[model samples]
Target: MRNNGAVHGAFRSAAMRFFSPRALAAPYVVWMAAFVVAPIVFVVIYAFTAGDGAFTVGNFAEMGRFVGVFARSFWLALISTAVCLALGYPAAYILARESGRVQRAAVVLIMLPMWMNFLLRTYAWMSILERNGLLNRLLGALGIAPLDIIYTPAAVVIGMVYNFLPFMVLPIYSVIAKIDRSLIEAAADLGAAPRAVFTRVIAPLSLPGVLSGVTMVFVPAVSTFVISKLLGGGKEILLGDLIEMQFRGAAYNPRLGSAISLVMMVIVIVFMYFMNRFGEGEEGVAIL
Candidate 1:
């Protein structure tokens, strides 16, 4: 009886240890299992299975038909990311050098549009880019011919840059702001020119933030359907729109949609892998 009592005591001790304070992660683990992991599993299953439930690779084979879509999506996304980087780096650098009051005001201005509904902001851009819209109207007032700017790839890229530019700026600014001023001073004391100090000291230190911003801007830009739909006038058929059609439109092929989603996810993962490899030593901030 004493031996049996000791065995029960050991079991109870083990159970108590398992349910200790650190076990607060149980709810989060359960949530991730149910939401993130389970959805990925379902997507994989559906991607490989046909309507009749037989496993097949036909879904992936159909992806060949979307070559142009894949190309266009990546091209537009690349352009948007490039533009954001070009514009954001300068803005972030300048913002980092400003007084705290100026920095706060600038950040507020940058983020103001984001506080509004995303669809509403896109609609506002549509209004501004319309043939007789605000932009053209302003040009007419200046006696310049109204440019053909609306319902084109340019409009789509514009919408993307306007929306995602903040993501690029904030990360780079965070990194640039946190950089050790002593390094810049040291570079200056060593007789490095202002431009040289920036190129050699500041830019290298901020690469991780740049990488983070690139990933953030590129991922959403590649898969955005609403921007292409509203701004491209439904003419620009991207991978996002194609997948959405498969699932929601008359096409109604969830298997194909899942396959496309899986492929896109793989592509993104591979892209991120390369980005991380390029910024290997700076992994701490680069992946985010």
Candidate 2:
């Protein structure tokens, strides 16, 4: 009887420990350490060291040589993010007010494009944009001049906007869909005009979604190498291309690549900080 009692107590203790809150959180903690924390730590260590295993800051000094690359990437990403916001907001607003069937169709249309291989999607543009390709041939059929667009910065911008627009749309749609109909009704009951209703209530409520969308679109757009490479045709090297070259291209400087990665990460963090800081105002999206 004593032995059975002790066994029962031991089993209960194990069960209690296993069911603890900390136990449930352990997997998440391990995942965080393995993926997030470990990667950053490795980047930091590699970024601050030279090939000979000595500490150095020369990697950063070398990065200064590619200032134009950084600037170009930043400008391209900013423009793409802005364009996505312009195109996505109206689409999302319309979708938010749509019937269930229409809304699902719209969502499916947006996501369907993403289901294909990313490279294949980008390359498909090449066929449409290339000289004497479908677009040019279509223009020829209409007696319109065939325009040169492929392998240009404009092409790069188009790729960025096309690929990232859904990121902007989905977030805004989610926010607008959740907005209480009564709030809008209340605004209308106040004798406010449609423009006034939007400016006062709808826009402000959607600010967070816009901010999230911008971050989602901007980060990947800024870091994109494939889009710029295929579209820009290596004529213009952006920061991503630059960083990639450091590690894989002739330079083969992993330390420099790490430093640039670190700097880019810091820039993203700082930019997000300011965006979040500005967004925290109660008057967010509230026009004075």
Query: What local distance difference test score does each model get?
Result: 0.93, 0.90
lDDT (C-alpha) at residue 119 in model 2? 97
Cα lDDT for residue 117, model 2?
88
Residue-level lDDT of model 2, residues 69-131, one tens digit each, is: 899999999999999999999999999999999999989999899999899999998888899
Report residue 111 deviation for candidate 2 (angstroms): 1.2
Q: Return the top candidate by TM-score.
A: 2
Report the backbone clash tally of model 1.
Answer: 0
Please provide TM-scores, in order, for all candidate models, with all chains considered together: 0.91, 0.92
Kindly give the stretch of ten consecutive residues in candidate 2 with the minimal lDDT sum.
279-288
TM-score of 1: 0.91
Give the local distance difference test score of model 1: 0.93
